[model samples]
Target chain A: MIKTSTQNELIQYVYNELADDACTQLEAAFMHDNELAEGCSELLQIQNLLDTALKSPHQRAVQNILNYSKSLSLQS
Target chain B: MNTTTQVSDSALVSLYIAGNENAFEQLVNRHKNKVYTTILLIVKDTYTAEDLMQDAFIKAIHTMKSGRYNEEGKFSSWICRIAHNLAIDFFRKEKRSPMITLEDGSNVFNTMAFAEDSAEQFQVKEDTHARLRELIQTLPQSQREVLMMRHYADMSFQEIADSTGVSINTALGRMRYALINLRKKMLNSNIAYDKNLYSE
Candidate 1:
């Protein structure tokens, strides 16, 4: 099993939050470690899937917001 | 020619503050999906999410226009933080259970349907989004909060730590578990319906 610290680093690495040196080290480890690499792969897949769940608001609502700002601008 | 991708959110905010309306439009289009989803997860209603999103942006409009805007942090994070807070305050005042039945997410598919003609593919995508949001609602409150803040709000772990009142390590740990749990949930939800039931 990979260490908890390594797993945490993997999360940071996927999120692009790990420090540069640690990121370099993790990249090197990925070439040699199958389990660590698989963990990273799963994290990435889930991240993408989570991102796809994003929904857009109706266009009318957005139009209202823009119009409100425009109206305020006109008044100002 | 356009520099949409090349322009930073900060630059756009600066332009908008300088009274460039197009820049504000770009800013809204760029981050609208994230802002909407962040609140949708909290309020669990598209109509309410839309209303709250408008309120959030109006609040932002006033802040940016009134010279109170802070340029210290990423604009996406700042705006989403506002959206997130408004969503939570909504929950507090309403005291509603967030697990209400979701109208299929495709209900809002019309928002972007004007740009794309692939109705079949678009419907599938919206259905997936709806299912995922429903599953997110099933997560424990802490995990759901961390996941939404990090993924939807685009907040760094340090930012999440400060905002959620937890140590950075604890914040990271919660996010780690949240992702792991979400993966497991996705897998289970995918196979819950056996093929035998539909066999000819």
Candidate 2:
């Protein structure tokens, strides 16, 4: 099993927040450990899936925001 | 070609403050989906989400125009933090519980342009995405909160820890479990985790 610290670092690594030396160490560990590599793979897959799950607001709503911003600027 | 497309959020914020309307437009278009998604996940309704999104942006505009916009952090993270807070405040005031209230994906998924996806491909994408959103709502409140803050709001784990009153390690732990639980639930729900489906 991966140590809790390693798992926490794994989270940071996936999110691109890990420190440089720690990230290098994690990559080195990934090569030697099948479970660690698999865990990384799974986390990445979820991250991508979450990106796809973002939903957009309606077009009119966007237009309203833009128009309001412009109107406010015009008045000032 | 529009060169502002390559401008960073901080640069865009500066341009907007200098009264370049296009800069403000670019900023809104750039972060709108993430901002909208951040709010929608909390309130569980598209109409309310859209309104709250406007309120959030208006608040940002006021701050920027008043010369109070903070330049220390990423503009994406700062704007989304605002969106997240407004959504949470609305949730508290309404005293309504979050439910999987998305009856149709069309309302939430708007006309933002995408690559020329085939009709069949679009349907598959929509179904998988809608299902994933439902699964997100099923996450425990703490896990969901951290996930949205870190994942959707673009806040760093350290920021999440600071805002949520937890240690950075605890924030990271919640995020890890959030991802793990999301994967498990996606598999259980038969949602697509396939990279190929989204790569097109």
The candidate that achieves the highest TM-score relative to the unseen native structure:
2
| Residue-by-residue lDDT tens digits, candidate 2, B164-191 | 9999999999998988888888878777
Question: What's model 1's overall lDDT?
Answer: 0.83
Clashing pairs in 1: none
For model 2 the interface RMSD, in Å, equals: 1.7
> How does model 2 score on DockQ?
0.72
Candidate 1 stretches with Cα past 4 Å from truth are B1-5, B99-121, B191-200
Candidate 2 — which residues are off by over 4 angstroms? B1-5, B99-115
User: What's model 2's TM-score?
Assistant: 0.93
**Weakest ten-residue segment in model 1 chain B by summed lDDT:** B191-200
lDDT tens per residue, model 1, B6-64 = 78889999998889888889899988889998998888777899999999999999999
Best by lDDT: 2
Q: iRMSD (Å) of candidate 1? A: 6.3
For each of the candidates, give the backbone clash count. 0, 0
